[model samples]
Target: MPERIRFLRERAAMQERARLLDGLVERERSRLESLAQGNASAAMPLLDLYSDSALSEAAGLPLPSILGAPADSRAVDDRWAAARFCMSLLRGRKDLYARFPYALSEAADKNTFLAWLQSDEGARSTGLTPASQMHVVGLFSGDFAARARQAFLADARIRQVLPHGLTPAGQHGLFGWFMQHVWSETETHLRREEVLWLFMQAAENPRMELARAYEFTPDWQRRFPDALTVFGWPEFASWFVRHYGADPRWVDVAVAPEWHEPALQLRIGYGARGAWSTKYPLALSDVGQARALIGWLGSPEGDAGLSATARQWCQALDLPAVASELLKPGVNIIGHFCYPSGLRVSVESIAEALGQAGVDTSLRDLRTDAKDDPHHVDFGGPEVHDITVIHTQPDPFFPESYARSDLAERTPRTYRIAYWYWEFDSIPDAWVDCAKQVDEVWTATEFIARGLRERLPIPVRTLFPGVRLTPFEVRKRSDFGLDEDRYTFLFTFHMMSVMERKNPLGLIRAFRDAFRKDDKVSLVLKTSFGDRHPAELQKLRDAAADSNITVIDQVFSPDEVLSLMNACDAYVSLHRSEGLGLTMAEAMLMGKPVIATNFSGNVDFMDDGNSLLVPYELVKLGKPIPPYDADLEWAAPSVEHAAQLMRRVYDDQAWAREIGARAKASAEANLSLEAAGRRIRARLEEIEALRRQGR
Candidate 1:
């Protein structure tokens, strides 16, 4: 529907004109050959044979009024004229093709050429003769990436969201970027799926509920930050997937057309095999840890199918050996683990459980001085065997004094274990100390893995940070309306959070420069402070206002952000770095492409074929910093190159959309919910194995 798409479509028609010429020339040669051989034939030879009196006569019509052409000069003249006409059309076709690049279905284009031949007298007059091959020397031809882009873009949803190619009509430059990124991503994506499973305690009634609606969404940069964050929880995830995709439920309990308009197909995943919901009130990561422990306990027969390592973890948890049965006939664990603000329950429950189970308990006895109360669950515990803890942060939670002093002051010297200790700023020392006593280490990303492997004598597998995506509710373009059809830029800038790695100051400056260079542009910053920049925010606002920029800020649900992105034309991150930049993937899932810096796990999903790569350039703390922030400072890598890229999107709507579409394809391919979950599940297995060893 966009102008650029229309152009590509029309250009394709023009390109096919030349192919028609090829057919004309071939026909000429056939006619000439027939005449040279002397043949004259036409349906009902009697008409040409004797005219009412020829009743049973024959014309030398090649000894055969059997055929229609004179194996004579008539055929020769027909061939010559056919050749000339073919040559003329061929010349024009070549010229147009050489000048532009666009899409054309070879089969369809051929059919149309056949129709044109019937109308052109010059071509049809060569009757009974085949077309000849024309050797027009200087013809032009260009290749368009049809099959490749089609594999990604020619989907029903894609056709619906961006009916025509937007990349061709707008800024040619932006269009190119979109094509390249989307192509690479599509080449990789073989399936698109969003699996939602409802897991609760078996006692509460465990059943798998499936969602039934979906939408072709936009890229992260095109969506608001609040819209992005709301997806971090599970309830939101279940709701979004249910509404945006097919309802897997037998009967819909909650149906809201305003929210469930079918926009995308829902594909199922491995979630088909259920897991117990664990019915706990916490992060899945913590649940994973619990499952690992449960796996440690051997079978009640004292030797179920679990591995030796899993058996050990079971022992650590003081869980009874597995039931004589290897699999719990009708049991599934989906949501039984929940620990917020740290693990719940007191040490006494731990000690009593272990003590009753006949496990060793002589080192810890905080129960004596337990002031948190006996039944309160936080009371002291008896001696413990080994504690296998995981680090979710990049830095150590305590000094050696805090990490070891407490345990040393009053506990046994067993295998007090630690995994992925890089969080310790001084890991070299932590490694040597831990290695001297503990077992195993873990890393979250490739960057961290490489760094840890270099320093420690152990191996590290790149584990993913625990993340569960929440889905977006569907809504109207006007719900969070921006007055114009202008491309809307989105950023989830944490008001002033030290933990985040987004580059605020750099973003402000770049946004101002890019938008100021053009008037028909808008930048919406999703922050807690609504356009009220605390002095710092003001400077950026002042710069943007001076440049005649449209700035937006507001509080809305994730669905609203989805609405805005669907209504907008493009997305821009232009940040320097990101671990995985979940937002980046989310943007693509929404069908909007993104412009992200070339760094970190963002690479795991963002590629040139699907995303715009911007140069991130910024300085902090006297040296070049990375994209992730942990300590006192963090800088999302920088790109000094965004000015040009941003301007192109702002000026060219078609170009921006092509890029967004490409990005959407990438997310759907590689980072789809199903794909990400599998990766998470695999890592969960590894951690389970590791913790069991220490147990």
Candidate 2:
């Protein structure tokens, strides 16, 4: 006989065996049921659970004659309920029926098989464990899905591939693989419900087959993008539910991890964003069009469309109608203004500068509308702005904040721009991918731009940072509760920033070494968000011990902080690195001579003519510094040189005043609000020109 014929013969033999076994069990079950007819529980047992009714009354009787039944005899629903009640009495439980074996078979096919397995003759003949007996029940259930589960579980090839864990997730993976084989062999298209039923049955028990099925499936993530639209196609939907464990939702698609393929996740995010614009629709007939929309939405310009709100809007209208909404022109700075973090302050400074230069600018909090800070500015409506300035860290801002900002659907015509800042030489891999998603990338300094331009395949521009320092009443040492006549050396740092990189320790060490316990000079270490870094705060306290250092661990408002800075004789920073050191610039603007490490982003403004540059040797980082690793080298400021500068500045008041004046002049000339505004407006104009050309 041919191999195909032999295989068919084996399958047919198994089917015949199953049929014979089922018949024997059914006959024995019926005989036992007759013996248990007198039992009280058997008097419409299942029906009584719903409502008391006699078995005789339910059997082949009109439902209305029974208590609370529908009056109409033609009511199929009432008739079926009555029929089910009568059937449940016949289907007996262990104590309900005297002959439980017969009752079990009547209740369910699996129950009958289980009863047969427990019998002395059946147990001796089968020699099956309880788990094995359950497997057999699935096998003899007379359904392809049940048989498939048994065949897959029993297959030697499958057992070898099965992983140890039988978690629901593991079962899903196995089913995803098994589904491919099941679908490929299926002669007729199965309904989604039918496919779901098969999976539901297979997942009832853990067997080697599930692992085999999971291992067999190839490039499951590749099928995901198609899975969303191919809902009617049972195979795709089955695979999707198994892998993802839910119907495809916008949040799941937008934030899928690497295992799902970041590229696909990115496209899904884009597609989800684009679907909001009147130019785009939630549902597309063409797969190619859907994919294009996804990719477009994922881009920087379409970032606004990915929000939950955008999705809700798109769901209500088709693409044609959404596209018909007229667009407005003018630049909008969508950033983190709701908080008083460094990013928020930076964004506000840029926006204020642009306004000063007569540029039409507005502010919109992208991810959050949180009205926490008293200083947060309202930019009117997010819709009125045409050009978007995404002020954030590249990878982080894009993935978490910008991806859900929902600007694309709201202002689809706006030319989206990203102003990003990074401290280290190389950007994160995610950031590199994000750079291309926008039309142009802006950096605060050329130092930052140089690193980005070297790797990013996008237009990169340099825009210097601007500051709006509010003038506070010039307070004496007595005003801040400090001893009068003490020459205060102020060192301010935000605890939110990396304490090690900020090198507050270096300043503390230098301060402690330069000044004596009895010296009239005081070192004021003003830091905020101490709770975030309690360990660092403690370390600071320990260093300040036995010295004339006043550690102010408190959050001060803008004016209060300005008063503190203005009260100090000089501002000092012995930082290991900086990304446009904002405090140092602010100190310079205040005509206060700054002593800082002559390395990294601060090099953009810090020069020998205006500020004291501490000499340092390039040293490898002691530990992993996020984007920069142990291999990365940064300046380790000379503590000896810092001490010398501190003492020199304290002794020569006239020289310090002259340097502070020059520092102020440099800041006014280079970091003025007008200068940044001019550069930003020019860039926006270029972007607008390009947008017009593309149109």
Candidate 3:
């Protein structure tokens, strides 16, 4: 009977201890919530209570309650205790401000910060760099914590990784440390989603084996493209190495080519599905590898060595072993390659020319899919190369296609070149900075290069756009189900390019004034990207409501578009300005007389001897389009004059045919693939000569 009584007493004592621990945990959790809600008055007390000894003493429990808990403990006692400690250390506004210093400065910044907190991908947009926003559950009170916990538990990846389950201490310990380290490593492009994904993969398996991760065609690669970049984070890598040991897959690292060694250089980037592929700098999977190469290239010895290595690699890879950097160096031209638009046509033409010039040219698509030209329609995958040629708008923010957001700051050590243009007399302020950064500024025309050079310190080169007239399958008016009896006037414009620049409305006005309703003249307004500007397209439709205007809104394949140009009686462009007037050149190459404003870039190739150049007067812009200053003047072709020219082309078929024949001849002499190839070769030689002379 005495033994039984003693056992009951001990049982009661144990129950009391358990209750004490639960109560302490509850109190700490409450304190954390208070702090999270901006109760600064309770912060110091909460901090004191969260100390190791204080927490242990208050709970009447040992450190092992949390430190040695199972992976999947859903219980709140020690979980709350550990969560409280983490919260105390990193819960308040101060903690957030510390990570993102500008978060609370301006109203916009504050809104952005709060918006991030409320976002579905909070970790991606907020102070929780490497940390998952799931940790925020510990920072709030009542139902909020429960909801967060439930959501976290629901994640498939998390569930897969945590078979044993998540303990509060484990969450706080590893995650907290990782996040802190990530916060310190500023200037990283690592998204919070990517970190969480990496952590889950690392934690679930714990084996840390990474061999299959880098495989050229790993099964998991299609699902997890960002897997490799995670290893670039030193904190995660260090922790992973310590816990899981070095990955066996990394055995190839020892054999990986040195920075200056003769090995194939694969230029890769991220894709639409967030998978890293051989696209552009944006999809770059191996940040650490690139950085290592960058460091080496920054040194003179490394630079010389890499230059020699690039040539050797080119030879081994069966790429064009071009002249050295002094002339035309082997270049990786990164842009929208397979896109079937006029701009893409120009880009492809340049790539072909570069190839013909004996320069190793790899055309990388920007991972953009177009019905006319899907991703990698021309060339893709890993290859040997040197230098990076970004062919897009200079400003990273200005709807730039090839300007990879990450490359804006993480400038490569190679001879970076930006092939860009602006419509105005003075380049945009943003473009000036971009130009200032690049080794060379390649403009499509002397007009643009001269304008930019006046303001920029960088050397500007006139790299005239190449025109390649490949024989396309002949398509007729019936192919588009158009009126076979009517004479068709074709005009093409991309909506993404500002409407005011393309001046489609002006063209519509000229066409309306030129021909009568009874006249057998139909206008084909070839428009693309109508979805982006529904209202503008509507306006165009409204303008053409009473006329014989056939609007082909859908993007057509290059062969079809070229055929459409061929079927047209004449091509007309009342464009205010063009970078190179690629479409005008294409029309000329197709044996079609081009009626274009005799100003800006068109003047580079258009002339009265071969084509009709509509006289234009310089007109001031009403409002400033960013990059296009209001003070600058663009050609405003007289609508009356355009109408007169159209009448002459219609009434005098023999004269038009004569002009068309000359246009084809002019295109052959000035804008042919061979001519462009020669130009590229000459320019490359000049660059090589300059480099050899150490100029």
Candidate 4:
């Protein structure tokens, strides 16, 4: 009796659920019928009752029957009724209409849809919503053949709409179609506005085959004589010369009164070779354009390019004055200026110091890959300089990497210097060979200089690049999502610099061992380029998961980097080795206590008095880590020693402050811009004296 009672209750519950489902189904069916009858207001409530997938499945059958049925079978009124119902359904849920039930490839169905789409009523229906219009175009895929069909259809639609103006959706659809199909293939009669629109669109789109629109230029020029003003003369000239082979007509148009100012601006701006200082320089291939520009600047219009001060200084200088000024000697500090590497900072510091010494300096950014920090500062300089400082690794220091044909031709008398940094004890033979190409080598630390001097016959000097900190804003711990109350220890690095060398996993272990999850101290690992080494980054993340640790894989500007260092109470680097330990020095400059391994280039500035020097064991690398071979020896820092130092720094605030103050004094004295400037000036003077003696 008990079992039968239980079974009866279960059956009753199932029957009640079935009844509710039946009611829902009936209501949905009514909504679908209303949608089919062109009553969108009644059908809109159905969306809440059913999921998008469910409503799409239910409405799929009726939509195709109304729009895709054979045209001959339906009378004009019946066809209009079908079109209205289709419009209502589309309005109800426009996103569900991406896939149509009928074959779009079928001629009858396509014609039926196209006829309705082209009609006045169809335009009003689609024009009601951008989504509806977008869905209509979405029916045609963006494949080459599909694009051709869409382009043909758009030509007719655009021609009709050309009298007024295109809606945003229409413009978007037309732009898409034109990007894939050639503009010449369009049968629409070209008007001045239409030609200008086409030219501007093609010129702006990096993917567009701009050469296809070259035929329209003559018409554009004939219609609008100052068309270059509208389409930016420099950009147009770049394309014009690329396609038309340096025509004098375009040159005259470029230097015309209306367009001459902008062209002169481009001339005074840094050229394509990344030479920030050189005026009116172009790539070797762009010499024709450069020559034309030079010719124009040497003419009466040349005064437009010069500043008032320059004009007064030269007394309305003609070609000789311009030539003399353009040919003046300056230092070209070339490197990966855009990258967020230590090399970028080194190059920037060198440039700043040279500028301070009253030596004219120009920066050339050689990095071709995506910049790590888009907000990185651009230090503009000259097009031509006499001395070339190549701050890069020896492997990529060849002419092919830094000195392109154009740079080589311009710097025939350049005094080449390689400012290199290496962390290893022994130098690579290839590096030694590459060093011969430069007149001398400059290194930031005596450790690197000693190795180079022993190996190379040429001069190898220890010249520390200046360390200057000008933070944009004083960022608090809360700005970086760090706990304000907790004493934070920051470790910043770039994963592209090599994971094993940075040893972030070791830092994580040390941090975890040093404190508990509830500890009032926190660790923030500010790093970038971790995406390239997912496994290593994942390992670090897993190790720090249970601790008061935050891993920030991002890029920061130079100012932001200094601000980050300012936010932290103490900075830590458990690195196996360092080229110059730029970040460590930056932290020291910010008056933060630094806890780093007592090894490599950092040891030049870091000592027992100024910072916490963690003990390390010298060990040979068991496995090859690219730049550092298996046999090369590097410091293996004691994690226990680092952990103890971190705890001590957190406990001893007054002691930490004293150490930080000492660090600031040491960094300012040794790494100041003035000191670096003095060193660089004396060296440059020596080089100049030697050059004068005909060495």
Candidate 5:
């Protein structure tokens, strides 16, 4: 089957499963409603069908009315029925179990229920066997005075049933029950011999899974620090290694002589930890395990089991050596390198700048399904490097991207940095939380840096990305279906970048206000991704109707896009927000007079001396446009001010040419390749200095 068809089928199956789960929750709610209003006999049968685990999820029904039902009459059968109802509710209701003593006190037949609770016949009916008697007693004694509860735990019958070992099924058994219920009441209740026996059983149980044993190990270490010595080191080591040899925590027993032989065997069996392995080595993350591995590799036994290359890698696990490796000048720029998006442009520019500065750099593509682009150019270098700069946004960031790339094997030693961009005044809390995973953050503009520095505790610095467009052969206006005699103004955008923020409609309004359909001037709106957002595209088309405005919604190669900009007389963008306006910068580099909003990241390079700047009012985003919260603020550029500027640029051709020259000089001074390269190199050198100081 084709990939698209398979994806659609999988999506349909997921929707069907969601509907089925919704139906089950609805049926459970209806049944619960019936039980709440009905009598005891009617509720009993419905109670049997209740799914404690599944029905108690986020969509769970509330506690049934039977829980608050009036106390039963003195009739023997009615009292028994009431007791059974309470027991049934206790199955999964921890809330009710904690307050069961109060419920029993309110019952007129408390004595009768207490007698039945300890009877074998009652145990058979409720499934509360002798093994769980302690749990029942603890619940019933919740209302007792402190002294009385202590006396109940000290009873001889309770002492006889105190669990000393694991059950045949490998469960913690009655000992776990005692600890949960009465351990707080009196720690001295269990004899020392019984405590020792329980620990011994837990440590040596062959049937216990590694996860279950972890539960006991911590408590054992806390209460008895020398547990390995008491249990006989050789015997305990054998058992622990059998279950937990692969676990990095095995270093806890590394001091013991018995641990050496098994440790060597286990390391040899696992072989070298390197990039070729599918599993990430847990040992490298643990300080004790990493140190021990280094020591073992230098030993005679370890020498025979490993190759020379593996031995050298293992020995380099020293902290100082790792830190030195991280300070190297090489970098791995990770992102969607092949995709034709703003992020890809930023990555390419940064890589080129680094290369020009004589810094070693490599490009690692994270996206496997990038759209086919005939204009894509490969940026090649080494597969691994000392530093990794991730150019993805925080909201969709996943460490799995690193794992899937060639950089994963070197991740533990690499200094990770996230190069993020945001347009809003405030970032989402969830995105901020994800950003914390990186060592530091670098943003393209101070607008983004300020927002990040306020929320992020780590280093947040501004580094402008370089902009260098390749020389393209200019095409005539007639070739692109534009009138040769008309003065053309161009604006390009992607539909995926929210339409509200881009405000192309506001631009259309400004253009129509500036010129008429019969005027010798034209506005060409270049855009893409219209197929996914047909509604927004239709709105744009409807607004541009019967005007000198032409909308071209199609994908274009990088060279073609640059040629289109060259064919036009000017560039414009009345955007509400921008992380960093790349297109406007590109146009300015080509000596085109640019008119954009006097706000956001574009302001970093644009000014009154170089470009036409439109005034805007800061307004609250009344409704949320996904990825941006409703409370955040963005610019609302004035259409009247923009229209006046548009007319001025068209009427005075000589002044426009002078402004275009200034724009080009400003771009070359601030957004040039050498400028960006200097900033990156200085920041990296500062980081290396900090590492040397151990700050």
Candidate 6:
């Protein structure tokens, strides 16, 4: 009878403890939410409560009753307690502000209606992995063992390293079952990755304060193609939704629906998917239009430098609050990247160039790809150390076909190359062989480098790829019969046979809004678009019906472009992510005040007081479209808000003039071509010295 009474009392006590723990969790969550909103009144009390509870938990008394009579004994109790502590702290607004100090901004500066919360966010520490979802899809797919038996796949040696599990039917039942999900590919790039790299990219993205929602990709993993999931795309899509929700398809394609059977099994079966890969700096390159090659090399910036998404992806892969200082390097790594592009620059030719420059650079050329022997590309000659080889977007025409090709055989020891943005998990077979002889790889940005560490069997550093700038051909005001004295704002948004990520509609809306409110400002736009997006183009034109805007959709010489940009009062390029924003930097160098949406490599240059930075807003498209699986919502500065930014610059001519002067000074000292060239040369020497030191 006494034992029964005691058991009842213990059971009651456990329930009470569980209730207490739940309350703590809720309290922590509330405090965090309040803090993020800068709502101190709400958070202050919660923070205090949290502190008190944490202290109590540390003592292991006043322990939630659910932990049972032995308060120190329950393993599960600790998890609940830890969750209450960490989650609440993570949610704190003050902490968020401290950690991401740069994330706050004014909505007016963002210039778009879509930019809401982002108005308060700025260039803080964000990177790829910080917003990635680590969904383990391969392990649960049942067909792994079967594919391992296939002759074609056996050579790649993938089955050995993939992290996953499958149903007991040996994958004969469900292939890569969505239910078999092991980790989120969204957490990092498609390649195996480490936390450091993923965090780097995530840190970069959110810094701009654009809004992109989130999306999920549900695939059926059979042994071949569908199974070869790339983490970068999904993560990118997620960021787009969160940071640049201007277009809506991102969610439909990425935010996966419930997992169904055998959906995407053909990914690898088609062979290497590199052929369909997007450009490295996808936002800048417009497809189908022949670029009017510009020749003038740009100058480097002077001295002063400073510091510098997704999803549920934002939720699931919340990277630990990274140190902002890490994002701000005392001396950033800046240089010219020689992507193994163009046969004109043979490995030997490169060697000659290096020799002429008085730098000792070795060379090595590996087949750009092994999938096709005829297209095999080989690099040899002066094997340079330290300087990463700029392997441009994969070329189907890469030279690896000749039986005489021995790119790898010529690889010089102590040299390394950078993998392009999309070249993670699926490296060319020859590159793998060459890696053994090479030293390091600056895989895209630092974010990708860290992510690559997890996916690759080798080591990689975060050396970002940069865009080159030279003077653009100056387009005189007379060329367009415009009054040179008017405060002309240059806008480049158009449509053509090719598609670029330039948001023309956004340009029109921004211009329309700005001009409607202020009459002194006029805009000159260089634009083009593809035939398919007629509605998009027409809508943009319609928006500009009441405005004094000159829209030209044609190729212009670099000199002409530069001259026009210089003549203009200011220049703007509001692209989402050009990997690196060359246009903005070039304009900055030309002494034009600039405005750009925060993303990609572009964020590398945009800084406080240098030029106007805009927050991204989230936009949603209801309909599903081809190339996009479902509707999505994203965030970035909107055209409405962009107009506001223009208004500020347009209204304040003196301020605008001052801004332009600063813009030029910043770019010249920090991001000029000459500066980058000098940096590259120094890197070569440094690498040589390190090699000599046997580092």
Model 1 regions more than 4 Å off = 1-391, 394-444, 456-459, 465-469, 476-478, 496-501, 516-518, 529-568, 616-620, 623-640, 683-695
Clashes of each: 84, 13, 15, 6, 0, 145
All candidates' TM-scores? 0.38, 0.52, 0.56, 0.58, 0.54, 0.39
Q: Which 10 consecutive residues of model 3 have the lowest summed lDDT? A: 403-412
Q: What value does the lDDT take at residue 271 in candidate 1?
A: 11
Give the winner by TM-score: 2 or 5: 5
lDDT of 3: 0.56
- Best-fitting candidate, measured by lDDT? 5
Deviating ranges (above 4 Å) for candidate 4: 1-250, 253-315, 318-329, 372-383, 397-399, 403-413
Q: Higher-TM-score candidate among 2 and 6? A: 2
Candidates sorted by TM-score, descending order? 4, 3, 5, 2, 6, 1
- TM-score winner, 1 or 3: 3
**lDDT per residue as tens, model 2, 230-260:** 1112344344333333333311333222222
User: What are the per-residue Cα lDDT tens digits for candidate 3 across 416-534?
Assistant: 67777666567766777666556887878887887888988877888886888767888789888889898889998888777788888888899999999999998999988899789
TM-score of 2: 0.52
Per-residue alpha-carbon lDDT of candidate 4 for residues 303-333, written as tens digits (9 for 90 to 100): 3353333233234335443443343335777
Candidate 2: Cα lDDT at 59: 25
Off by over 4 Å in 6: 1-388, 395-416, 419-440, 443-474, 481-485, 493-500, 517-520, 528-546, 618-635, 682-695
RMSD of each: 29.3, 23.6, 20.3, 19.6, 24.3, 28.8
Native RMSD of candidate 4 (Å): 19.6
